[model samples]
Target: MQSHARGHLVYAASGVLAVHTERGTSIVPANRVAWTPAGFTHYHRAHGDTDMRIVFLAPSIARLIPEHPAVFLASGLAREVLLALTGPRNHDPAAPDYSRSARSRLLRVLVDELREAHEQPLHLPEPRDDRLQAIARMLHERPADNATLAELGKTIGASTRTLSRLFRNELGMTFYEWRTQLRIYHALVLLADGHDTTQTAYACGWANPSSFIAAFTNIVGTTPGRYRTSRRTTARASQLPTVLKSPD
Candidate 1:
């Protein structure tokens, strides 16, 4: 993981990007934008064919956003602004170089749009307790694991009640909720990798595709089939500090 002096927003033009931090993990799919605040230690992993775009925010602008990492719905206007500020369209033969003042104005607009956009629940908060960590590792390694909290606790040498309390205190969610999110994250990667809905459903531990479909749509706002076939909108790169480096 690496820390940056400037806060940055990343957009996945296609595929999915997972932003891992000490706090937990944030999933960035095509329709969402992810923010990592300045000085946060983070690393990224790309799933499938990804066209990840990144824009760094200046302190003046960064202060307007939440101090913690966040995932926001990328509204139509926000998406366009991001693309105009960073995509190939950012350059113009008529304008030659896009001026700093103009780009800054665009960024202000982008921030305004983002402020109006709903923050999403794409974050999976990390667990710090030893028992919770053990449980988390177990689920992460095999999202297909259908073990109950009691069963998981048994393996970790923790009581189900104790583990339940720890999950609430440390991760701010129930075991089932956390597991569902973890499975969704994995399902997204599988789908991006060209796995069909049925395959992904089972791979992520769903007993049936219908169940997986419901859970996926609840979080992602779309069915897996449609989501896989959807086209990517143009957006993301920087140096006003709107630089586009190789995603890795």
Candidate 2:
């Protein structure tokens, strides 16, 4: 993980990106954009054959954005603007170019678009307590585990009530709530890897496809089927390996 001198915006033109920082994790699918303010140590993991693009923001524009990392829904206009700014034309000397003034105007519009857009609940906050850390590690390894908080506590040496209070006080959510979020995060990665809904449901601990659909739609703002279809063009197995050359 590293930080930049200037804040920047990253867009996954295809596939998905997850931004990790000390605070938590933020999932950035194709329909969203992520902004990381200057000097926040973080790293990004590309999921599938991601075509990620980035645009650095000037300090003036950066201050208008949140100081911490955040995810925002990318409107059609916002997507177009981001592509235009980061597209090959900017690097290809023979291609048509944008003047400095024109670029500045585009940056202003981009920041304005984000301001008008609402923040997404895609972040899963990190916990600090040792007991909480132990619990998190176990579940991270087995999201499909259907064990209740009480059942999980038995293995971790903490009482159910203590664990419940820790989740609330330290993470600001209940055990089930955090697990649901964790499951959804894993579900996205699974889908990116070409898993069908039925497969993803069982793999992520959902009893059946229907239940998984309801929870996925409620959190991701779209059905798993639709999300899968949208990613089909970008994540073909044949082209996924190139992403490893540079995981940024």
Candidate 3:
């Protein structure tokens, strides 16, 4: 996974991803588009053979987003705008010199669409459960850490048996699986932040890069390098103004 930061925007895109947020985890399909706001650390991996698109925007583009990771509705128009903005054709012109002003115009339009796009809750809040809240916070803050059923039971003032039952009834997944997903989610963020997969794997608590690669490919449908390369190539191809340098 490769991610680069440009201005206030850190765009990370992949195909068929499963996203885990503080509230919960869900799968993102082609019909659905996903993104996280600036400075909001989140993770996603491709769920199947798919192509993902991400576009980050500076806070100056919109005042509505204050501080939080959010998912926005990629309306049909929004999708079209993103495609056009990222297309290779945007960089090409028949003139002797590419116009910087034209490239800026396209980027402006792309940013406008992103800022105006509708927001959605990829993960909803849980019922009034402070313990769950604590667990969620801990996971987001440090996804590598694991709590056994007995440990969590003691920490949350419940028994292992009870905690097991609650996890099934409330969270809908076993503790280990949930933790794995959380770590994987955060790993994606690290990867998108320009952290190497090997470092991300170690930092996110994977046994090794191979293990991380296995999980990443299985869930994100592509390797981290492929994902980052695509995003960079798309961003550069879409926004770079055509320039001609005459022989000196």
Candidate 4:
């Protein structure tokens, strides 16, 4: 809990949330945008640990914005443009300034897309009961296990019927849906770690690569290879090893 209020824009690049406040709680997920108005005290509980970008706009820059704490769904173009604008070169003066001349024009167009973006709800609900927490933890611990709802219910000491209702009422999804989201979210971490999709698929409990790819593509808006390539391509500051030349 915070004593003083503050205004900020928080983007969850990956992961999910269970946010609580007087404005009410929300479930948030990847590629989603949230702008908290000045003095809104809220505590965010993450569904899974995630990487995020936060731009705290002062009153001067923020006064122009109409909504005080608006949440929006980020479009594909906006997401790509943001990634590019915030790429490695932007942080390093020694790196070729991609902001020069013609490059500056391209950047302008990308920023415009972000300005017109709209919010979409990505939050996943959760149960207040501790028993459900234990079940959720088990699911998180073995994302690839593909535990059937019946199996999970048995382990958690709740009947499958009761668990199904609990999942919908408290978690806002059927057991299977929640599991799928968990798998896709975890896959992004593996991909970011430079693991190939095939290996990631198996490691994450996917029976095969195709299934994992489908799940990842559906939620992440891109394939694992494409995402990895984007990472490496934008990794402009990578140090190279020097070797002495022996022969021409």
Candidate 5:
């Protein structure tokens, strides 16, 4: 958990990463990256054995990015540049004279590529009001809890109408909409942890697999099974050691 004066791009070379900020939480997998603007208080948590890579940008370059935190797809060129910039040798503090000119050029290219990358629908916005916060916490702690807003309001001592208004005004979404987003965010973590679709659906408060699949696909751009499979594939590939053949 940390924030810095410098804005940075965060990438996960092998596993899933989640970036939590005031605006929302963004999930980064192998195919995507997250950008945290300068002076923003944010924290990251790795979902698995993650190979996280970060590139700090100067204020001038950082200003070109979104002021709020965002998640972007890692383009082919961006991925290559990221690997080059974060590679072991590039971080050698004593090797100042090593390809200084080329490295600077690569950094510019990386920023340009990221600027054009499309934002993913991975952000889970937070609600600021105390009433909304309490509701969010309850849903977060017990994702499987299927209590309706009216039912929840009884426990929290707020009218269903008041809670609904707060959700829209603070979070810019209805109670149901916000709850679905929360469930999807939790679903991502459960799926990454290797839960099957049916189990994840039930755990995330979906009444059935079909409904869950529809919601997950609409938000995540893929089915739960596909998302899990992709994560597993990336993890296994990252673990494989490089092999070199003897000279013939």
Candidate 6:
């Protein structure tokens, strides 16, 4: 989880993975992958039985990706390339020269695939100021806390104006916007943990399920029900037997 000299791509063939870095935190589901540039201090946590795969990139290749941590949609080709690189068949130290050449080609393909993929809006930027951090910690611990920004500011010994400016200048988002993003992040985790929409809505501070669905869909690009269903489907598929003989 510590910073490395080489950048790496993290993907989960199933389940969810959260990557926390100085720049932000990325929530990566089965269909997405996260890229951490070299020399970034980061850590990861898996939400379920994750089939995690990682590929380290040389400085030259890593430069092609973003300087900051990012999340991208894992395309079909990208997934295949990742599996090939991390699969046991590709790990022989004494493999023939041709095998090495094949691996090199696959690595290039993987980088190219990532370069062309669209980035996902799965990142949650962290606050830097001490007061903002205090407010963030409180909300993170209790996502359902519906305190107004003015109310939260008073508790943190900062006026509403100061807090608003800090949120805009430091986080590049309004306080409300930041809170909504945080709530959505928590809602994603809860949903992945098998909480239904109504339960997730209340847990994340949404007064109504409809409002939660709207916000979740806006940020995650899918409704809560669909997202949860997709995760379950992927889990089931991963658990299926590799070979099934057809009846004669």
RMSD of each: 3.7, 3.6, 10.7, 10.1, 6.2, 6.4
- What CA RMSD would candidate 6 show? 6.4
Residue pairs clashing, model 3: 1-224, 3-192, 14-52, 16-47, 45-220, 46-219, 46-220, 46-221
| Model 1 per-residue lDDT tens digits across residues 1-248 | 89888999998766789999999999988767999998899999999877777888888998998899999988878876776766554544564555788888888988998888878889999988888888889888999999999999889898999998988888888889999999999988888788999999999999999999999999988899888877332322222223373322
Over 4 Å off in model 1, which ranges?
89-95, 231-248
TM-score of each predicted structure versus truth: 0.91, 0.91, 0.51, 0.60, 0.87, 0.88
For model 5, what is the C-alpha lDDT against the true structure?
0.79
- Candidate 5 residue-wise lDDT at 207: 92
- Per-residue lDDT tens digits for candidate 6, residues 50-86, read 6677878878767888988899988889987776666
Ordered from best to worst TM-score, the candidate numbers read: 2, 1, 6, 5, 4, 3
Q: Please list the residue runs of candidate 4 whose C-alpha ends up more than 4 Å from where it truly belongs after superposition.
A: 1-4, 11-52, 57-125, 235-248
Estimate, for each residue in 1-248, the C-alpha lDDT of model 4 and write its tens digit: 64123455555555554455554444445566666666767676554444454444445445545443556666777555555545555565687756456455544554355468654433334556566677768866877787778887788788888888877887677877777766665666666656798988998888999888887777655687776665454333222221111111
The 10-residue segment of model 4 with minimum total lDDT is 239-248
Which whole-number lDDT from 0 to 100 does residue 188 have in model 6?
Answer: 77
**TM-score of model 1 (CA atoms):** 0.91
In order, candidate lDDTs are 0.84, 0.83, 0.54, 0.59, 0.79, 0.82
Off by over 4 Å in 2: 233-248
Q: Judged by lDDT relative to the true structure, which candidate is superior, 2 or 4?
A: 2
Count of backbone collisions within predicted model 3: 8
Q: Which stretches of candidate 6 lie over 4 Å from their true place?
A: 91-98, 239-248
TM-score, candidate number 5:
0.87
Residue 78 error, candidate 5, Å:
1.8
Clashing pairs in 6: none
Error of 3 at 188 (Å): 1.3
